[model samples]
Every structure is written in C-alpha cells, then in structure tokens.
Target chain A: MDNSEDTERIASVLNGDISSFEPLIAKYQPRVFATVRRYARREDEIEDIVQEIFIKAFRKLATFRGEAPFEHWLMRLAVRTCYDFLRRHQRNRETNLSQLTDAQNEWLERFHVSDTADSGDAVAARELVELLLDKLSPSSKMVITLMEIEGKSVKEIAEIMGWTLSLVKVRAFRSRAQMRKHLAQLLKECPVTVEPIKTS
Target chain B: MNTDKLWNKLVDEVRKTPSGHSVPHDFEKRIMDRLNSTDAHAKSGDSSKIRSLDLLWSNLVNLARQATPNDRVPFAFEKRIMACIDVPLEVVDGLTLWSRAT
Candidate 1:
C-alpha cells in the first residue's frame, strides 16, 4: 500500500482496530531488520530488537502527530532501538576484539571494498566488509550503515539519531573517512586491482 | 581524489557490502505474532476510564447549558436563599391547618 494508505491504516489501528496494523508490519519489517542487523550481533537478538521497535512504535502511536512521514518516524524508532540494544549489551561485559585472526581480518577487509565491485568480486568483498564493520565503533558503524548503506538523507538521519544536522553530517564524513582509510590499507596490502581508475 | 567523490565512493562501497546472513524466512510472521500478542495484552490491560470520563464531562457541559437560571445560583444570592430557608415545616403545616379550618 501507498504511504497515505498506510498512515490512514495506522491511524485506524491506533483508534482500536488491531487488524489494520499488519500491512504496516509487512511493509516496513525488512527495512527495520536491515537497520537492526547493522548493530546487533546475534540473529535472535536482531529479531528481538526489531520486534521491540515495532512494539514501541505501536504503543506510542498516539504521540505521532504526523510531523514527519510515517516511514521516517519508524526508521527513527528502529535506529534508537538498535542503539539502546547496543548500549545495554555493552554494559554487560567486555567484547573480545582479539578473537579476530589475520585470515578473518583479510576476509572482512575484502568484503567492504568488493561489496561494490562487479558481481564476480562481490563474495570476496563482502567477507572483508563484514570484518571491517566488526572492528568499527558501534556509533561509527551505525552512522555509516544508515546514512551510507541505507541511503537515508542527512535530515532523515538527524531525526533517526536525534542528532543535529551538523552532527549527522560530521559523523557521516568522519565515518566515510575511516572506512576509506581502512579499505585503502587493505587494498595496499592485498592490491586487489593494480591499476587505479583515473578520476577527473 | 576530491573529498566529495571519495566520500561517495566509500558510501557506495558500504552499500554494496552484502550481509552474509539471510533474514529468516518467517521474520515478518514472527514480528507480527509478537506485535499482535503485545497489542492484545495492552488492550486488555488498558482502562476505559478516560473515555468514560470524557463522555461524562461532555454530557455535563451540555446539561449545564440547558439548565434554567433557578438551577444556577451565584454565591452573592445567599440572603435570598436564607430567607426562603427560614420557613419551618411545623409553621408550614400549622398554616395549612389554619387555612383548612378557615
């Protein structure tokens, strides 16, 4: 269904008609899960986080004054939920960064750079990307995942992260720089393609 | 490379990064099941008192508007109210008895 229809349906659900909410869940679940998976470690945890986000959204539906698009609001909620999950998990104990071996690091480094490479190069690149992402700070990784990978605009990201426009831009820029530096180092070590593409 | 172009390339690369893990096939169903159960639980627990109060307040306001002047008295009208209140029931009964005797 279109956004307008979804809004109307959500409004109906908020007014006590429960069945109207199913379409909304079906429509936005993939995006929500994708956002959650960027930060969450376990598959079960990702599912739980997504469920929590949707449940929160449904419960707080009354507070949604339509000031923003429904999808934008939902995205904001999803990002916040992921952030909360990360923070909660971090408080429990230490993360084992030393567990990454040379082979795993190489695989992850390749994954990030080759993710955008030709279809033949995708698999190897993906492995590298995953590894590199694992090394990043959750905040940095999240910023990149939402603004870069998800293609959400700066304004939308600011809303999602509860950050100022300038802050979002700054974080995005920093995150991109970090990823580039890491990928560049990986590229230097492995030298995936000898000849660099000429840029004007 | 110019920072702008470099940034774009980095973003492009990140976007292309494949999540090796596939989302579970029943992901939506699981989410919906949880949402439905939670929603049902919430509705069952929520009180209808607010709705009832709103209806009651609305009716009261409408009734106040329809009420005659006699139904609404200002605090300054106490003298007139006291004068009316002074008639004892025995006096009233005795006056009625005298009127009947006459």
Candidate 2:
C-alpha cells in the first residue's frame, strides 16, 4: 500500500485496531532493519535495536500528527535509536592521530577507490568502505550513510539526525570529499581500464 | 564535473553498494506479535464502564437529534427506558441477595 494508506492504517491501529499494524510492519521492516544495521555491529544487536524502535514507535503513535509521512518519522526514530546505541556503547572512542598503522592507511586508501571500479571489485570495495566508515566519527558516518546510501535529502537527513540543514550539508560534503580523496589515491596506485565501445 | 553531478554520482554509487545482511522474515511477525500483545493487554485492562456508558449516551443523543420533531420519541420510549433501568435494578437486587446469603 501507498504511504497515505499506510498512515491511515497506522492511525487505525493507534485508535485500538491492532490488526492494522501488520501491514505496516510488512511494509517498513526492511527499511527499518537496514537503518538499524548501518550502525549496529551484530545481528543480535540489530534485532534488539529494531524491536526497540518499533516498540517506541507504537508507544508514541498517539502523538503522531501526520504532518510528515509516517516513514519519515520512523526513519527519524531509527536514526535516533542508532545514535543512542553508539552513545551507550561508547563505540566511537576517539582515535589518536599518531597511532595510525600502515595497514589501516592502506585499507582506507582502498575503500575510497572501490566506488569507480568494475563489478568484480565491488565486494572488496564494499568491505573496505565498511572499514573506512568504522574509522569515521559516528555522527559523520551516520550523516553520510543517511544522505548517500539511503538517498535522503538534506532536509530529511537534518530531521532524522536532528541537525540543521546547513550542518547536514556540510557534514555530507566533507564526508564525501574525504572518501573521494582516499579512493582517488588508491585508484592512482592500482589503475583499472574501462573498455571503449566500438561502433559497427 | 559540477558538484551537482558529482554528488549525484556519489549518491548513485552509495545506493548500489550492497548491504551484507538482509532483514529476517520473522521481523514483521515479531513486531506484529508485540503490537497484538500490547493491544490485547490494553483492551483487557480497559474494562471501564464509564467510557462505554459515555459512548452509549452520546450515540443515543445523536440518534435523538437526527429524528424529526414529530418522530423524536417512539410510542414505547418511556416503557423502553423504564424496562432498561428495571433490568439493571433487578440484577443489583439479585447480587445483593447472593452476597447476603453467602
């Protein structure tokens, strides 16, 4: 069902029609899990996070005014839940500048270049990208993931992350540039050729 | 390339990046199960006669308002209201008698 229908169903569920929530879960579970997985490390961790997000959403359903789409509101909750997870774990502990290893630097270099290569390199590139994301400050990584991977607009990212529009744009730009620079250096070191098209 | 084009390409590349995991099949079922349980709890806990009485009274008032002045009261309106009150009074008397006997 479309968003409007889903919203109406959710409203019905909120008003005591419990059966209406099933379709909402079916429609949104993928997006919700994907959002949670972006920040969570283990499968169990993600599962817990997803459950908490839904429980929180249901409890707060009475407050939903339907001003924005329900998915947008859910995404905001997902992002907040991830941030709370990160904070609780203290996972984004600061990295010392002088402690960078050669292997770590090389991995970072490979990560940025993965985007421009052929399909064969995609898997390796993605792994590297994941590693590089782990190295970033959690906030920056989240901003980049939401805006780039999830295709959220800056306004939506701001709403989700609870940041101003300018802040979201600034962080997104910097994150992309950082990734691009690292990837470009890797590409220079290991050049891949693209075949030219021949006209018959 | 312009920043707009570069941004678009970056976004497209990111979108194409596959996630290592898929959402479990039981995810929705689990959520629905929780919602259902919560709803059931709420319904059972909400055994308030006051709310139901309010709803019934409001509905009755609405029905009366919708009727024409000539058709406002049924021929047996007084009898129906008296019967409704008498049934409840009889039930209360029976309950009181049982309580006294026990």
Candidate 3:
C-alpha cells in the first residue's frame, strides 16, 4: 500500500474501525518479524515481540502527526521496542565458554591460530558472533547489530533510535572495542595447541 | 594477525549467513485477536472504576493545592530534619503499584 492508503487506514483506526488495522499488519509483519528475529532466537519469543510491537503501534497510532511516512514512524517504534526487549531478556541471553558448540570452538581455534585464517563455516561463525553479541550489554548489542550487521549508517541509527548522532558514534566505537575484547578473551580461553617450530 | 582483522573477517562471515526465518502463517490473525481481546477486557467495567478514581484524585489534588499556604515559612526543626536527610521527601498517591522485575 502507498502513503495515502496508510493515512486512510490510520484515520479509520483512529475513528474506531478496529478491523482497518489488519491491512497494516499484513503489510508489515514480515519486516517486523525480520527485525525481531535479529534480537530474539526462539519462535515463540519472536512472535510475542512482534505481537507486542503491533499492539503498541495500535495504541500509539493517535500520536502520528503525519510529519513522516507511517512506515518510518512504525519502524522507529519497532526499533525502540526491540531495544526494550533486549534489555528485558538480557539476563537470559548470557553466554559463556561452556555454552559454545564444537563447531564454534573450532572456528575460534582457527582464528586464534591465525587472524588471517578463514572462518570457513559460515554457520558456525554466525553462531559464534551471536554468542559474543549476547555477552555485550543491551545497548552495545543494539548498536553493533544496527551498525555492523544491518549496515545502517550512524545517522540512520540515530534517527531510528531517537538518539543523538554523537551518542551513536560513541556507542558504535565502544561496542566494536567491546566485541573485539570479548573475541580476544574467547580466543585466549579456547584450548588450541600450537605447533612447535622446527630447527635445522 | 590483528584482532581487528579477525573481527572484520568474522563479521563478514556473519553477514553472509542468511537470517532464514519467516513470519508464521497466522501472525496477523493472532495480533488482531490480542488487540480485540484487550479492548474487550478494558470495556468490561474496570476502566469506568479507574476513571472515577482518577477524577476523584484530581479534585483532591486541586483542593490540597488551594489549602496549602504558599507564604508559610518552614519551622526550625523541620528545616533541620530536611537538612539531615539528603533525599527529597516523596508523597505517594497510593494509586501506582511498585513494579516488580519479570
């Protein structure tokens, strides 16, 4: 649907036509599901977060001033809700060396052996990245996910999150450093044997 | 063998990994059901009671505001007690419940 259609549906919903919201939900569910999946792992948790986002959007629909497109406003709400979800579920996302899968451990071992070595198995590398991301603070995780994984610019992140540009930059820098530190620690803790140098 | 290089490599690999999950088939229906259920629950008399309580509280607040003497000076003991306590005194209206961690 176009902007005019969104405005009309929003008007209808504001006027107490509840069923008018279904079209908006249908249009946005896939995008919402994609965004929520980055933060939550379980199917049920993803669905819950998605439902909460839509429900919240419905309640706050009256506040839309039409200054921006409805999609932009909805996305801003989505990102903030995701941040809250991350903060709320942070304790449960904790990861440690013991929780690493064998493939993840092997990938870490290869990285420790040589920084230039290929991580090779994309699936294991992705899981390892997720594990390290879980170890970060909620704010840091959101910053990293938006800036690095999602390829969002600093300005875009600031806009979506309603944060200052400087704050986003600082957060991006700090989160990268934090991720590096965590990776180094994991590599140090990983039990990889080093081959001895041969002599003549 | 820079750590930065390793992190960059891993990040590239992570980007290559597909997100791979789609929205469930019945998600829109579920959201509509939830919204409809919440609206129905809110309409079931509790809201009217809350509105009445809210209106009463507002009138009480207005009365209390008008009754308080703005020019009254603080008594010496009260001032001393206030000085001793660093925290500001807060009056609870008793309507809000303390939030518990989930």
Candidate 4:
C-alpha cells in the first residue's frame, strides 16, 4: 500500500501485492520507453516493446537482488530486451529507395550532391539515417544502436551483450562499415524522383 | 565513394535526441490490466489442459473397452497395418469397416 518509494514498491510487488507493481511501472515507464525510442519503428511498436519489457520484469522480479539500484537493473533489462527485439527482426529485408519518404529522399539527395551544410532539421536527417541503419544485419544494428544512439560506453555494451571488449569493438566497426556501405549504395542508386506504380 | 562525411553529419544531428516524447498517460493502468489478463489466461489454460486430459483419459478408456478379441476384426486390422510394408493381406472379407468410434 506504500506508494512513495521504489524499494518498498519492489518489496510489495515481490510479496504478491500485485497492485504495487503499478508504482514500479509508473516510475520506470519513461526510462523503459527511452530505451527503445530510436530502435523501434513506430509509436505502437515502441509501446508494445515497452509493455513486453515490463511484463518480463514482472515475471523475473524475484530474481532481482537489491545489490544494485533498481534503475540500473531495469536499464540493463531494457537494453537486453531491445537487443533481443532487434535479433527477432533480423530477417533480411530489402530497403528499397521507395521506402524513403519524399522529404527523406530529398534530404538524402541534397546531402549527397550538395555541400556539407547542416540540414537544419536534425530530426528528419536522423530519421533518414535510421532508415538506412535498419537495413543492416541484426548484430550490426545492435552494435550501432547501443554504441551510437544510446551513447552507452564500450565496456557497458560489452557487459550488456556479454561480449569481450575486443569483440564489441570489432562488431561496432563492422556495423559502422555495414551502415556506410548501405548508405553509399543508396546514394549511388537513388533516382531524383521515385517512379509511381503504373497499373496494367 | 567516401561516405564518412555523410555518416558523421548524421551522427552529429542525431546526438541531441529531443525530450518531447513522454510515456503514455494511462501506461500504469494498461500494464495492470495486462498483468491481470495474463493471470486470467494462465488460469484458463491450466483448467482447459486439465479438461482436455480428462477427455483424453475417457477416450482411452472407451478405446480399451472396445479392444475385446471379438470386438475387432483382428486378422483384417493386422493385415491392413502390415500391408504398408508389403505383407500379404489375410483375404478376410466382411470386416473392411471395423471401426468402433462411429
């Protein structure tokens, strides 16, 4: 019944006071949502992934030793969940030029053809960046998202993914190369205007 | 082609992630509802599994009841089962439909 603190909330939840889980979810929902903002494609998908993370946390609550702050443990769980989510979606799907919105295609064309000026809308450019980033292999996507977007340190990523420091470094390098390669291919092949489908 | 410049540009732009996105307002209620529904589903699943087990047990009992020596065309059934491996049929007639469940 105590709704003031996370520790008491965790204790209450673990004690079968199922209603206490509401506070934990309320307190950490933002951070959990933060973990997948860049990685998840749509708003509903982000919510679904966040929901799954909380569900998993609820199921695995008994295993949560109080050795670390609950936030740290939750973030680690969040990271692992996002990594698993990316792995599940690692199927090879082609990223055609048509997938890009008209604005994104224009931005890509201008960025490639013109000078290195700031495109002003960092948001849109970032979205376009993710469009290409999503086409990479699962491991590559995880490495890049963990290293670049989330700004997690190499050691932290290593700990989270259970990979050696060197392995993490290698994966990050290869992932960046993969992203660059895809971007290069996209830039070379992008037509000025996408052709509309013609009906027979 | 060297795409390092483009990649770096994207990196710089994306680094400052905006803080406008917020967790949905009814997120807590939604999660509680989900947990309750999951518990309900698990309970229903357990009950259904028990019911199905009972049904299967009754099915087996019925099957055993009909397993009497005279209840089956044993020779015909044996030949039919063995015929798949090229064994010769016992040439028994008048027992082609020796099923009990019907």
Candidate 5:
C-alpha cells in the first residue's frame, strides 16, 4: 500500500474503525512473518510473535507520525519485537553442542574435509547457522541476523533498530567475532571423518 | 579453511535457502481477535488489574530464572521488577489470544 492509503487507514483506525487495520495487516504480514521466522522456529512461536507485532502496530498506530512510510515504521516495530522475543526465549535456546543434529554435524564434517567441498546441502547449512546463532547473545543474534542473513546494511539496520550507525557497526563487528568464536569451537568439537580420495 | 571464509560460505548458503514459510492460514484473523479483545479489556477499565497480574507473572518468571546457576540475579529483583514489565498489557492479550487460537 502507498503512503497516503496507509495514512488514510491509520486515520480510520484511530477514528475507531478497527477493521480498517485489516488491510494493513494483509499488506505486511508476509514480510513480518519472514522477519519473525528468523528469530523463532516453531509455528506457534512465529504466530504469536506475528500476532503481537500487528497488535502492537494497531495499538501504537496513533504514535506513527508518518515521517516515513507505514511499512518502515511497522518493520521497525517488528524487528524490535523479534529482538524482545529473542531475549525472552534465549534461556530455552542455550546452545548445547551435543544438540547438534546429524545433518548439521555432516555439514561441518564436509566443510572440515574440504573448504572446496560441495556446500549443496542448504538444509544442513541453515541448521548449522541456527545452532551457531543460538549460541550468541541476543544483541549479537539480532545484529548478525540483520547484517549477514538478511543482508541489511549497517545504515539500514541502524534505522530499523534505532541505533547509532557507529553502534550498528560496532555490534556487527562484535557479533562476527562472537560467531567466529562459536564456529571455531564447533570446528574443534564436532566429530569429523574424512573419507580418503581414491586415485585411479 | 579460514573462519571468515567458512562463515561467509555458511551465510551464503543460508541466504540461498528460500524463506519457505508463508504467513499462517489464519494469522490475520488471530491478530484482529487479539486487538479486539485488548480493546475490550481497556474499555472495561480492567487495565490496572490486568497490568498488576501481568507484572506478578513476570516476577514469577524471573524468580524461576534465579534457580539457573550462572544467571545473574536482577539486582534486587523484587524492587525493580515493576519497571521491567514494560508490556504487561500484552500478557493478558497474548494469553487470551493463545487460548482462543489453540
């Protein structure tokens, strides 16, 4: 939806026409789901977070000053909500290296055998990345997800997160370091069996 | 392989993974229900009571956290807890929606 339509909808909702918010929800739910899915794995958790985002947008619609597109404002709230979700669930997500599934282990084993090895197993790579992410502190998880996985620039993340550009850059750097520490540990700790290459 | 190279490779692979999850079938409906109920609660003037109950639940969660060995006790957990229940309204709203959704 365009900015003027968004403004009209916000005005309508603020004027007590609650169903006016449904169009906004329809327009943004996919993007919001994609973003929230990065922070949560379960269907229920993703649903709750998405519901919370829209509900929050509905309640806080009055505060949206229209300086930016409604999408930007809503997405900022969504990212922060995901950050809060991460903090709340971080305890349950404490990384146990032992919890690494066979797929993730095999992916690490392949990477260990050869940097040039086929990284064709996208599922395993994704799982390994999530395991490493679970090991990070919440801020690091948020920053790294935005920067690396989502491919958002520091400036864009700063805008989304309401952080200083320097802070975003600093956090991005530290999150990378933290990820490296975890990755190195995984490399050291994960069992690897390299099959010998047969020469004809 | 260098850690940087491996990290970059892994991120590349993950980004290539399609974001396969569509929004749930009835998510919009669930959200509207939650919003409607929250509005009802606010209008019914049960806001303060809901907030206190929500704050109490948050304190209970934090109390449970104190049992974890390495976790820091939130410096006088009881004294500053109310300050931390930032979205108490949502607790009631979330519970109401969750029960209905399930």
Candidate 6:
C-alpha cells in the first residue's frame, strides 16, 4: 500500500480503531516474517519475535513520519527487534559443539572428498552452517547471518543495522574467524579419505 | 586463517538460503487479538477512573459543591471536609472553629 493509506490506517489505529491495524499487519507480515526467519527458526519463536515486532511498531507508530514508505520503516524495526532478541537470549541458549546428525555427517564426509565442491544444494549447506553458527556469540552470528546467509553487503548491513561501516567490517572479520574455528573443529572430527576430488 | 575451500563452499551455500513468501494462515488474527486486548485494557482503565470520579462527586453532593477541598481539613479528613462543608462561609480557615462546632 501507499504512504497515504498507511497514514490513514495509522491514524485509525492511534485513534482507537483497533481493527484497522489488521491491514497493516497483513500487508507487512510476509516481509517481516521472511526477514525474521533469517534471525530465528522455531515456529513459535518466530511468531513471538514477529508479534513483538508488530507490537513495537504499533507502540512507536506515532514516530513514523511519512518521509519513508511504511515497509521501509517497518523493516528497520524488524531488523532492530531481531538484533535485540539475540542480545537478550543468546547467553541463555549457548550450546557446546553439537554432534552432527548422520545426514550432516554424510554431507560433511562427501563434501570433504570433493575438491572445489559445488555438490550440496542450498538447504543442506544452510543446515550445516546454522549448526556451527549456534556456537558463536550473538553479535558474530548476526554479522555472519547478514553477510553470508542473507547475502547483504557490509554497507547495506550497516544501513539495516544502523551501525557504522567500519563496525560492520570488523564484525564480519571476527565472524569469519569464528566460522573458520568451527570448520577446523568439524574437519578434525571428520577426516578425508585417501581419494580426494581431482582439481583442475 | 587460511581461505579454505570448504569455507567458501559453505558461505556460497548459505547465501542461497531462500526467503519465504508464505505467511501463516492466522497471522492477521493473532495481531488483532493482541491489539484488541490492549485496547480493552485501556478502555477498562478509563472506565474505572470515571467510576472513581462519580464516587467522589456523589460524596461531595451531600457536603455541598461550595466546599473547596483546601478548606480547613479536619483530622478525619473526609469527615472533616464534610463537617467544614456545613459551616458558615466565614469559617473557612480555622480547624479550631470546626473543633468547637464538634
């Protein structure tokens, strides 16, 4: 929807017409959920974070001027909310290096043998990466999630996160270092066999 | 750290993690329910305040509206304010006068 429609709906919501808020939620839910999915995975957890985002957005609706499209404004809120969630819960949810599943082990083993491997599709890759990423601190997880998983450039991530460019770069560097540490540990657990993929 | 081939492979794969398009079937309903509950809470709070104001005013009608709350408040406070209500308009300031009347 356009800016004026958003303004009208926002006015209605603020004016105590509660149901008018529904359209705004419906229109933005997919994008907000999709963006939030990158930060969270559990069905219930995702719903909570998504719900919180709307709650926050509603509470701060008065601050939203018509300067930007409502989606753009809401997205900034979504990203910030997700980041806040990680900061709050990351320490409590810390896990040791988890045992890889048989499927994961099989993928890793096959991957170990393939030189310059492009064999595994996206889903398997994402699963393996997410498993390792769980061990990183929340800030590192966010840096890597945006940089690699969401395919956001550092500058873009800075804009989305409201951080300086240098901060994004530094976090990216630390995130990469942390990921490499995880990979090194994983490789040690699962070694390569004698026959490796032939390189060009 | 070495730029290992594995890291690149993994990064490329994760970058392919798809963004979803499907929304929950009841997404809008969930938000509306939350908003409705909050609206109800605010409305209830306002109604309760109005109820309190009505109660305060009804007590005042027996005491007469001319009694300013600042008038010599007796020790019983409410009873004193009420007692002061019936006193002569000239007896506005003295708790001593209300004590004598009692």
Residue-wise C-alpha lDDT for candidate 6, range A109-191, written one tens digit per residue: 55545423343333444556666667788788888777765668989889888899999999988877677666556655654
Fraction of native contacts under 8 Å reproduced by each candidate: 0.00, 0.00, 0.00, 0.00, 0.00, 0.00
| Best by the lDDT measure | 5
The digit string of per-residue lDDT tens for model 2 on A1-200 reads 98789888987887777657656665677777766766765677776776677767776888878888888888788789888887776664543433334543443344333322233333333444444455566777787666655557999777777799999888977876665544334333443331211212
Q: Candidate 6, which CAPRI tier?
A: incorrect
Tens-digit lDDT track for model 5 on B21-95? 435546669999999998997875554433433332222223322222121222332222222322345546777
Please report the candidate that would top TM-score against the real structure. Answer: 5
Residue range A67-142, candidate 1, lDDT tens digits: 7779988887888888777667754544343344565454434433433223333333334454455555667777
Candidates' TM-scores? Answer: 0.51, 0.50, 0.59, 0.57, 0.61, 0.59
- The sequence of per-residue lDDT tens digits that candidate 4 reaches over residues B1-102 is 369988767655655456564445476699999999999999977665444333322322233223221111122322322223233337755554454324
How far in Å is the alpha carbon of A34 misplaced in model 5?
Answer: 1.1
DockQ of each: 0.01, 0.01, 0.01, 0.01, 0.01, 0.01
When only the first chain is scored, the TM-scores of the models are 0.71, 0.70, 0.85, 0.83, 0.87, 0.85
| lDDT for position B102 in model 3 | 22
TM-score-better candidate, 1 vs 2: 1
DockQ of 6: 0.01
Off by over 4 Å in 3: A109-120, A193-200, B1-102
Residue-level lDDT of model 5, residues A106-131, one tens digit each, is 75566445433343555566666667
**How does residue A158 of candidate 2 score in lDDT?**
79
What 10-residue stretch in candidate 3 chain A is worst by lDDT? A191-200
lDDT of each: 0.60, 0.59, 0.68, 0.63, 0.69, 0.65
Off by over 4 Å in 4: A1-4, A112-119, A192-200, B1-102
Q: Where is model 1 chain B poorest over a 10-residue stretch in terms of lDDT?
A: B65-74
- Residues B1-102 of candidate 6 have per-residue lDDT tens digits of 566988767666765666674445577699999999999999977665444333322222222222211112113322322233234357456887888799
Which DockQ-derived CAPRI band holds candidate 4? incorrect
